[model samples]
Target: MTASSYPVLPDERLAAGVARLAVRHQGRYSVETVQRLIADSYEQLAANAHVRTHLVVLAERFAAERLDALAHIESPTGGERPRVLFVCSHNAGRSQMAAALLAHRAGDDVIVSSAGTHPSGAVDPHVVQALTEAGVALDEVYPKPLTDEIVQAADIVITMGCGDACPVVPGHRYLDWPVPDPDGAPIAVVRSIRDALDARITALLDTLPGA
Candidate 1:
């Protein structure tokens, strides 16, 4: 699609984000493609957003992730690291904690992503605090909706509490963790959930190829 046919973003900040992402993905995706994804990402997040202060930046990050997943799905390279996706009812609590914990433990041994069946406006504050106390860096973490490209790209899809909501794709390994949701829970409860996820992640890491 041509640039003229692309929908204009209401926020100039989002337009700028589109430009940055277009340049970052230059040669891989057309500006039009980047613009479309950014616009769609912004719309998706805005629909549930309670605070608009960081929406533009979060939209850019979300679009970047989708673009990367699309690239992985379109072009498969041998020896690429395993990709793990965590899913839950809301990306705010369980899934976010799982993804962060796995990423921290696995480092570059695995590629980690998380999404929600029904994404919330932000990551739950208690979730963030729990992760922070564990020394997991969550500066860029935010709740995002599950997307087709991401699901298709994952080598393993782990569901926390999303049940049948997470899409099923043939040949991708799927596991369901019956972990409790941390939303509205106190810090102590959130910490316990974090530790439970961490233990699961440690066991999961051992099963990966390199482990």
Candidate 2:
């Protein structure tokens, strides 16, 4: 089959995302570099038969996540704090909210991360709005696939609705929050989920080693 079946088109959304990531890169690299990275990231998942659409949006997040990881691989905060990994059915809603809330509340006290057992094309719009309304910045995050390394690196792993999809790693602290998946849910429902997560995060913070 020819590559024509899988064309990489740079539309307005993709360009806008590239621009945002370029700014986030702090001029360390040119916009061209960031855009290329995003294109490459998109191609990484485009081959997956399961990923039918949303290639542009997923590329933006995957590229940003990869770049952010590269930016901090050698930083001093790499392993200084407790690392928490939030896993959900799709890393778009509950887990995203949890990480955002914890990161906001705990700041540098916790290294917060999130992923999906079955990754989604994008984050839930309602969840984004709820967190944005609650004052948690969601621009820097995108849904990502859960990997063994991320799970192993985390001091704590909280599962939302992933059930058996979430891996069980030895010596890794685990908690399963019975929070509803807010995908396609109404705004009020998303807000309730966000509030519940905020409370749970508050309690979780109290149990951390340094909290």
Candidate 3:
């Protein structure tokens, strides 16, 4: 009846090793029960990259649960729509593109977010240009670190190239798209990346609920 019973714990150091798990989740974890569950999940699945990834997913679920408990929060209730997260190593290129593309295409129907494993301070200008050329406004996009709350908030976590650096949470789906980095690439290449992502996002949209 607890998160600890789910699996065996990993070494404590692994928790520090896998730090790029969350995106921008703002949920607070003050409850002893929630902490226990997180710790238990972390310990049980410490050695498994996939299990750790599930832990990241669990973080999002917890965030949703926390939000549901708040009477003043304006977030939609469960099953209204699913949250999606896009992750890359820098949060500067591919992940940013994918997140923006999804948000643009999906609009308010889906919650979308993006982050980097080793996040740069700002998005790549080339990425900005590519998105702009693709017709998605780029004025409000900013680079952010991967965080536990963000991971916990997402129903889907898309990893670009972070591999094991991302975390795992149970009961969530994951997708990995091997998109190339467009930081310094020529406009042609950036456009290619954009087109590829657009196709992928279209396909992904087909999988979302009520799509």
In TM-score terms, which candidate is top? 1
Shift in Å, residue 28, candidate 3? 10
Better of 1 and 3 by TM-score: 1
Q: Candidate 1: lDDT over CA atoms?
A: 0.89
lDDT of 2 by residue, 25-122 (tens): 97575666677677766665554425436667767877776666555542436336788889998788999999999999998788788988877766
Candidate 1 C-alpha lDDT tens digits along 100-168: 999888888888899999999888999999999999997667788889999999999999888778779
Global CA lDDT computed for model 2: 0.78
Model 2, position 3, has a per-residue lDDT of 35
Alpha-carbon TM-score of each model against the true structure: 0.95, 0.68, 0.64
Q: Please identify which of the two predictions, 1 or 2, would achieve the higher lDDT against the true structure.
A: 1
lDDT by residue for model 3 (1-211), tens: 5535533324444333223222123253323334444455443233223224344454434333333323223453666677888998878899999989998999889878887777665677788898998889764555555666677767899999888898687876988899888878988899899999999999999999965
Candidate 2 residues lying further than 4 Å off, grouped into runs, are 1-79
Candidate 3 deviation (Cα RMSD): 10.6
Model 2 lDDT, residue 153, Cα: 64
Question: Distance (Å) between predicted and true CA of 35, model 3?
Answer: 20
Q: List RMSD in Å for every model shown.
A: 1.4, 6.6, 10.6
Candidate 1, TM-score vs. the true structure? Answer: 0.95
**Candidate ranking (TM-score, best to worst):** 1, 2, 3
